[model samples]
Target: MTTRTPAAAVAALTLGLLLSSCALLDGSTGGDPTDAPSAQASERQRPTPPFVRQGRMSIEGGNDVTFELTVTGLEHDGEYLMLEVTHNYLEDLPGSVTGRNPPVRLVDPVSGEVLRFLHDPQSGDEPYGTHFVPGDPAMPTHEGLPTTLRRYFPAPTQDVDYLTLTGAGIGLVPGIPLTRVDAFTPAPEPNAHEYIDPETFAQEPELPDEIWYPDNPPPPGLDTADRRQTMESFVDGPTASTTRAGDQETIALHADEMFAFDDSEPTADAAQTIRAGAQTLRSHIGPRVEEITIVGHTDGVGSDTHNQTLSQERAEAARALLERELDGEFTLTIEGRGSAEPLATEGGPDDEQARARNRRVEFTYQVSPGADGSADTDGLASARRHVAEPAHFFDELEPVTTLIHDDVDLHVYPMVRDGAYAFQMVGLQNSTLSPLEADLDVDASAVPGGPAQYTQGTLGGFRVQEPDTGLIRYVVRIRTGDGEYEDFADRINELATGEQYLALAVFPAPAPDVTEMTLYAGAFGQVDVPVR
Candidate 1:
């Protein structure tokens, strides 16, 4: 599932800072599964409601301040009201709202002066209407936080230019009463959702499962600086509404218009329906959209990957249409699954209606104020200087032999020669004064060999003799072509920190010519030395 967010800009900035401090990659933290609200700012003070003159209305127990307009006696089929609204009433945000191009006029009814609030808060050039959709109760012209109310109105009417409200001031519909639902505070902003202590920005968070694998390296293509943006990503729920129409379950997509698939290319009627659907989405939702992820699903009739691709393509096609027709207000990301994620779990093949429902595009919204702009990051920005990067054995030289040496209780394997080597070994404690010893066997093959041919042999057991004066010498003997003795070396090193394996690699003198070698105990064999 795709995730979208509202304060993604801030979240991204904060996340980037945390990731830069630690090192991680950019990707989603999984959507909706973690929908905790932000805890960045201090508690918002109880808001003061806007005043209206027509009738008496109060925002009951709800914390959100509501502006109620009683339409009991107004001599008309509908009504409208105008007022200056700002989202962040507690703070004065300059340029937070703009009317620059296509210059807008916010005519204040009382003062006759243009009052500009943050962003454009109009559904259309109106008397914002109060017409109710069928089955819906005769409700207010608007309901919800100022942002939600402005997002969708029943219908814009001629009686009002526009009904404006701040995030704190919500315009009420005619009959439905306003209520401040709860008093819960949002959680603090996380430094990194799955990577660091969400509260204490400096600490690391519980890591995800993928990081534990030795073979899994951090993805290289992503900009580490941008990883924080992933924290702000989230899913905002399904976009299409499902309901029963006639004998079938129908899903009405919220967009400019609605369209039914009949045959080749969308009909004008279908196009119009899509247009209306899109319009509905716009009127009820602003386009501060970061990414519009569309996932198209299908009935299970093909391979999982194929179905998945189909579903994704369906979503992509819908997104393409939306972007092309809607002035490119959204960045569309599309995906298709032929038949994998199904909405109806118990329906039979006879249920074409249910199958059709399953084969649909699911829309999710991701929001961010600075999605396209440079958001001020939360912490000090710094650069990381890597001491080294991994090099490959094939790139430097080819391995003539691949060896697998597993002795009782110990196992080691070499995949590439003359590169990095790794193995596991455990020492045996002997009762005799002499220490036990073992040799590493090798298997070689290839072409060229005379002595010059690739030869494999064993080394080590360089003689782990009796201890002397509390000091011990562990020797490593090398072997070359045709079981010939090579060179021998010894290390009177410290008793390893503990029983473990070690891995390292060294370039031999050449084919059949044994050069230097190393033997390590414990799991430490993965050591790679820089070849200068």
Candidate 2:
């Protein structure tokens, strides 16, 4: 699975933060205007910060199903203070010949209401390819916790404050299903240290050493013991409904329970005998049975490719026997898990027991008994309401102001000195008007560290820390705030921060009316620092 951008990474991290009983993460925002130490400094002291509230929900079913929710950005919207959240889920399969499709839905933690919203699963278009063949042992497999998905709403420019997510469809690979969805209030436009000129894609950074692309890798490690094996079901049955490739409605299957079979093989005869045993168990499968998965495994004794082939053959032989024994109109999908999992220590002294365990095949059942308790509507509802807001501290500060009109994407530039610094930005809304990108405007000024020119770019949001003794002399731009450019600069400058208080107030553009305030931020964009 492709690792999502850093912002989405934060969403996953947010869940970890919530699961831990940690105190809130805090940061200061605005700077003190006066340079001198005045007597009224006591009066200007900041107010106390609110305690960040957090909650969570975990649901499991046949073929491991888990979902988690984290609340991040919280702001008042009319009568209700809305919460920006990040949602994550995992689905692991145990047995079944067919891939399972788990449905996803969002529910209100308090009211138990299934929230609604426009879902765009195909928003980001990035084609990925690999050289490994389908059954290659070296190929990355999803046998243990395979399904990984992550989505980030950089800066929500729409009216989608409250969100509820549920598992809708998942394949029957006994792999972890991991997905993350997040929400946060917008800050000033982020200070970008790097720049990729649109004209030539020439990349430069106001801060050189701080910004560099990383060699992105898939986020899984299967080369270890203690690896869990998951199975996905595949059956060649006709679709219940007529639809395109991804539109067919077929029965979703998963192993209700699981047990491992392993033992070193004295030879090929032993392996065949164990497979025969598993086939005998197939006699238990009935018409209501949707599928059965016989995933084969090896002890990594040979080359990865060779071991994968051997594992696949073992799986096929077992599958063929079960299919012939079951004799049904149901579909069958077969594949190999290669040598991703081990049932025992490969080099243990009790080699006979180890070989027996490693060479043996166990059975798991996937029965479709109409709509039983597994489909308990109440259980599903209770599970959905288990959503909660996670704790966070908005530290490290940079602010930007943007002015948008009918046309022209007014951009912003960040100020910096010699070396390197990094930052992000988010847009904060001030009214009820729908957030429109066309109406957004941005800008930057008051750069520190001379003989030093700065470059500008657009990103999600910036970070802010409490202005303490040494933190001083900095500037930011309102990266992305859409609306008629009405007193935009004044509204941005009004942002305040101190020891305890962090206020995000917006001055309405001198206009006919003001409705709501929304915010946004850039995820990875950074800034520059002075070297000399």
Candidate 3:
């Protein structure tokens, strides 16, 4: 992942001037030094900047959502004017639009000039400017909190005295004076970075007869909808609707069919059953199956922990058996969900019949749409260590950001791999009466030219974060953000309140050098989270 180009790795900060010549991550050109002070002057006045703000204001989204956007002060960061904002969301239940980068415009108080946010119009709105926010769409409102955000606008000239804000839905905020220049937080210099080149395939590389993409090529909607429809089909019988070959196909198997009562090991006759399942996979997947995911489940018969492990073990056993039939030449993933997810939700815990029904494994196979005898069969490297939850991640969990309003604490424990720097994001003690949700992907902006993550758009979004020197690189391999691990998305989406679950979210990996990266956590300002 560190194979950055000479142009990508050039550190703009080392050049001394804030507006030094360098390629911005958003695929935009940079370096109009005329707006910035000389390097010597910028370094001299880097600290103890003056404060310049009058107060805050409120704006209603017409119905329901309201924002408490305050102009805390102003800072001159080279050519950009950093407007410090204290955004307090008022009068809403949990899951409001707190963690989002809504569009903002600036109206020059005197000249009546409207300054739209200066950014790559093609890029997703998040972590505005050079900051990366997982390149996801703006997250829906979460329980509103008191937090400060910095919006960088092209600095108003010395002639312009004040500027008012025009926000989407939130409407216009009061005016803020623009006096001092070049005394705000300077944008971090981008390090020599490494990433994929879109133009490399620019002539619109033929879309494979089918996209050999993730479960959700662009997002979860289609895949989830398919799953929902598949479940519906299951009610009618185990019939697959889309079996054009090389597309996605799913098969369901009851636990009783593969294992004896209370056992993880496959039964003797299970070999034939698994072989049949594998044949079904091979026939429907056609020439090459790019990926196979086996999800195991159990009824609410045992403790959650025990049930989860049992389910996992069963899934693993099933995988091993399938591999024997396939000669270990296919992509496979095994997951277990003890009683945490029962197929028979309405069934009581002690119901043996329902538990038996809940005990099962699901096999989902995806084949590269245009696969031939000579196609690339490499699938995403399956997690060597499967975790039932984020707590099992190989990193220490620590609170990274604490927001206002809701009793939610954002914690991140960094996980740096050889190719990327990923973090395990967690939201704790969401005391709302409903489940609280937080999408780090939706909340954070992806860095320009950042490594591709699972959450990236079809056009792709960069999620790399280079701090200080350009030596370390943080690349994101999109996390599911389904709250299976990070719980924030789960709780919030589920609207589960008054719960204290240590929900963890594991972001993709980053380069090893980035032991720590600075993130502007809500309300806390800039906080450095160490990638442990």
Candidate 4:
């Protein structure tokens, strides 16, 4: 994933001082020293909430760096919501390591809206988040040092009181209280090695002038306020996948079921499958939906020309059947992407399954307005709701379900619901005396493809399934402006001996009435766990 930094001028002036020890404090007492002190004392006397969340950053070439994060404030200043987070590294953060600051998002689990850092409209939509300081971007960090960073986002609804802070590598920190303040404040500095706890702070801190104010409305023509979250559903038999972002729906059909052995022609059963897809289109089509695109892809097996021609013919064949099945007059576009885009790793233990998944035809179209994004059941009968019977349902999530595979222990934790998403944490520990390449045999080919192909050593394969509805929720994906997708999970390459690394996977929230759902942990099989 590419890290989008803020504009050079703004980044250098504001974020460049991330490692500096100088504090930007406001000395103003607001006309009464006693008044300010009394306000501070009253705030300190209030019950202290859990404001600090701790996590470890596993640096690829360096030792694991433990860090504590404190959400100093998430204030809505009318125009925008400003988020202030303090990063306290327990060890020296090597300057050589870039992207020290992972991407952070404020998710309203109830609303299921994920708010990303606002981008500078003037700077070609570069996100106003992490950036490299002037000179040697890879500067070393000091131990027990507290660095504060601020990001702006579109404000959420007034009813939203708490939000979950999710960082790529830092995992999910839920239940952060949101405050509606008249003004934003700067982060308070920690005294020596001691950290400043915002929950117990007396008076509101002041923010630097540079970051407190930003251009309003984000300029004309730039669509920066779109806050729709994408919801995905994997049907039973794992036959098809549907992704809904806003009103647009993209349905991906498994080619193995549509065709047979290097054949461009649809098989006997293909008609039913195509009709199901056409039904899906007809059900979702709205007045705004003018055209639907059908694209075909093949696995990395045949030559470029052969695969390209075959993919094109297969797409055309599907189009022919879809035209007859549909009752509406809509423009249809067909294209073939030979072996360029693959949803799974071609040469791995699950090579055959990956290839079969790669051979697919996708239909992208716009659905009717006001359509429910979280609707589980779709048009296909075989792809409709069904029951998922797990092997076991643990009464207590503690004693965390540990699945041993190849001398490695993979621990699955309980699922907790936060607003519109469910958060699950899994730990991978190396039990062998020697360092081992952790291979839990997690395959994400069953899901749709994205920027990472959803298989680059990521926990994207882990999913949560509702037993009654048979609705499978894969890891949530954030769609970038370039029409690419990035998973909301951690990516691990290897594990050290006896080292237990924790990874988090975020999924779409199940029906409110459904409390117990089955967790499908790739090679570990399935287990029912209570959703808190």
Candidate 5:
């Protein structure tokens, strides 16, 4: 039940973009439960379909598309019905097809109860074949090729044999056909099928349940950013607590919390405390925060020269620690106030407790009014300041594949990152005055056939196979733009006129022994892109 989608579909989904929804298919409720699709009575009680040569059924689909439904395997061992389905799409996509939900469901023709996949999509427990397992299909060879996926439903008794496939924006065809089926070998038992608990499978666990209350800040194996959970500094500290001042938040860290007597270096205990303070700071400041001002102070007991030096060093130390702990996207400014400002007290400079309290560090952060990087960005404004270079610089990139489609020219540059294939989609030009719309999607599945449904397939998609071994180099992410990671994993619906954008698609790095690979791009066809 891994939410299978067309390789092109994930861009909209993974990026959280809301597109138009397709209308749901309607089905009637009353029908005989025991009737079989075939006239033979003996075949009704059989565990699988009788072997029929060329056993494939084609349905004329909406949007000028033809759906070829063929069964590769089927079996019902009491508890659950296991079925394999492959749908081959023929003809071109209709103009009306935009970013829309193509949700599909398995329906009981007789009972009218909508059935779900055996495993939950959110469970992250996908069958091995789910992503192009030899027989399992999530791979596509061409737009017109059949891609397969497996499905599970309440087992149909001897009386029940036929099922229905329903989808949004598509009409339901009763008594859908299944292809070549024989008695299942080593039939599976009811207990063998995985059952989903609604409560447990409702959503993916953000953190492992076993380490919900880890003894340390970060549970082992968690990402670095998640490790911030380990920060205990902000939780319980008299010297440091989050206090809101006007519109800004302040992490008020008392001197005693960070440093020991007469020391500019962070104390052994203060190291952990500072780490906690840094994590707390991130929660308050956020990644969008641009500036962090760290100011340090000292008591009146030290000479003005010594206090100034100590305050400067302490402020610098605190700034370094915070920068390392935070997202490191801010401009940090460290300053030394020395003994200029002490805690207000009746004894003033003479009070011993006040003197100790005077030595402290304060952190403040600020953000620009236009930090969201929307369509209109000042960064873009600044980019306009530089002289525009000629377009030929891209041609200098060696071994590029240039192809023209719908009057637009596309340049593909294959590169490597961390030993993985990271190809660039560059030089996308409209080459027309009236304006044009083009799909710039990429493939995510490694299989030759698409997922059971057509959603996971990519029309103009590509994959890499080791030339010597023919092993697939699966894709992981697709980003658009030239700036190192400017559009990392971003899905821009369509490229319009005058829109000059580049994309970078990443795959698992091939081994050093892999010197060459066969790059397969759906319509663009296969090409040999060298491995570095």
Candidate 6:
């Protein structure tokens, strides 16, 4: 993201200030230095400071509107943190740049935790944050003007100094300085066409309705209690992967990797893979884990009856090996899902890969409390040391690669590690004379229905893989206000010709020593991308 003030606006404001100073110095009107009229005029004409971040959004009629955002204050006020920002528009816009409820979040760069806007339970669970004032009429667009808004969020730990602001159409703005203050202070309004010196800007009177303090408790609503982190890891060779959400972990072993053709007997490598999974369970099992469930699934290829029997036999085979390896430490149960539940749409664009993923046997269990929900190093190392099959997906092109398809050009950039997440930005350009919609959604028909569904025209399918371990990292899931999880990327609709747009994709941060990984885009194949 980049930031700057309009050059023309700055020049015009500077010239006006110069003339005002000359008139005062020459005593042309014999006005007082602090005259109210002169002071008011200067205040209204004062130019705004350079914005900290800027982004462009395509509105109706294929018109692109550029929006600038400036953070005036991010202060800690005992109970919660108060955020003040100014939104500036460079030109007239037809629609609201940010809807009534903007999907904005403050991401802690150190812990990789995301903080969302607080909600008020007393008021029908309405969001505690808003850009419009209560009594003022809703103004969708200011038309070459600026609007100042305030929001509240739970404060991070004291050791943190900066956070990244993401979502709401703007690209990721990293390195936002976090300031500590005794009390919350209102942000000064910004001028759309003028540059204002920070020292000269005057603070407005505090609003009478401002009531977010300890004396007046916030509305009863959800806080950080429901906060949880989800991480996923895919083994390179065996079509095996693990997804950890809080204390629960699910290990997925592809059926194709475990069975020979349509047979239920374990393949030569199936015993070793099952043993690796058992080792992982033994390492993380707690007193609460009395039973582990192993479920088998198949792709949409075979008849329902045949798939059901095959899935059942496969689940039993996996359970048999797992039980032997565990040595009676835990009870095992098995089930056959057949072709009922899938992780991807079977007949999607990437049908082969999608079907390969769908045909899998999953081991689900709960880990010990307080245990860091991450991949078990010993278990992963054991799998790599024992399993001998090659990686299922390989990178064909190197980082900073460009792929042109369907009249749209996509430039994939190198990935950057930010705390526990890997962030990458892809540039999109429309090559045709008219607007073009990018096919970005990964087939998420398997996703349960909800507002958090990633298949709703989003970059949910973008993923990264570690070349050495073949650990594939899917886009991180975000907890929506309704408590469902969704992909943490923006929903891209269309690309306008002659306009450059950025798409953001975030995944679980790979190991510190791993400097490069392969990115799997839906139709773009694989690119060997560098990680910094």
For each candidate, give its TM-score against the true structure: 0.23, 0.22, 0.26, 0.61, 0.25, 0.66
What tens-digit string does per-residue lDDT give for candidate 4 at 294-381?
Answer: 9999999989999999899999998898888875578889999999987666776667777887888888887675343334344653
Q: What's model 6's lDDT at 69?
A: 64
Please give the lDDT score for candidate 1.
0.25
lDDT of each: 0.25, 0.25, 0.38, 0.57, 0.39, 0.56
lDDT of 2 by residue, 1-532 (tens): 1222222221212111212211112222322212215524522442222212221111112112233334343333222222233333333312221112112223221122222222222322210111111111111112122112222211122233332222221100000111223422333232221343322323342232222221111222212111111111111111100000111112211111011222221233433333333333332235566655555666546677876776666556555554664465335555555556544454644554444334433334442212112123222110011111211122223334443334222222221110011112222222322222212222222111110101122221122221121111112222112321111011121111111111111110111111111222222222332100
lDDT at residue 18 of model 5 (Cα atoms): 13
State the lDDT of candidate 6 residue by residue for 1-532, as single tens digits: 1122222121211101111100000001111112325544633433222225555645545556665666666776665766666665676655322231125677764454677655555544443444222222222333345555556777764356556666654445554555677666644342321322222322233222221211112433336544323323223333576665545667888778788877899999898888777777877779767999999988888899999998899999999998899999988999999888877676755777777777788899886744433456646441221111111111121237787666777777666555556677676667888887777535423222111223333567666667777665667666554556667765566666756566677766666567788877766666788765
Candidate 5: tens digits of C-alpha lDDT, residues 191-216:
11122122222223232211110000
Per-residue error at 91 for model 4, in Å? Answer: 10
Ranking the candidates on TM-score from highest down gives 6, 4, 3, 5, 1, 2
Number of the top lDDT candidate: 4
lDDT of 3: 0.38
| Per-residue lDDT of candidate 3, residues 1-532 (tens digit) | 2122222221111101111111101110112112236644532322221221111111112112333444556655445565655444354522212222223445442222334333333344222333212343322121243433444555544354444443322222322445575455443343211122322212122222211100100111112211111100011012111111113444557678778887998888788767766655554465544678888888776688888898899999989898998776678889897776654433433355456656777787664333221111121111111111011101122344554434454433332221111323333334555444533333244322121222233112212233653222221211123321111011222212433222222233323334676543323234566654
Alpha carbon lDDT at 6, candidate 5: 38
**What TM-score should be assigned to candidate 2?**
0.22
lDDT of 6 at 165: 62
lDDT winner between 1 and 4, please give it. Answer: 4
The better candidate by TM-score, 1 or 6, is: 6
Model 3, runs deviating above 4 Å: 1-232, 235-247, 286-288, 346-350, 367-532
Ranking by lDDT: 4, 6, 5, 3, 2, 1
Clashing pairs in 6: 47-194, 47-195, 47-196, 48-194, 48-195, 48-196
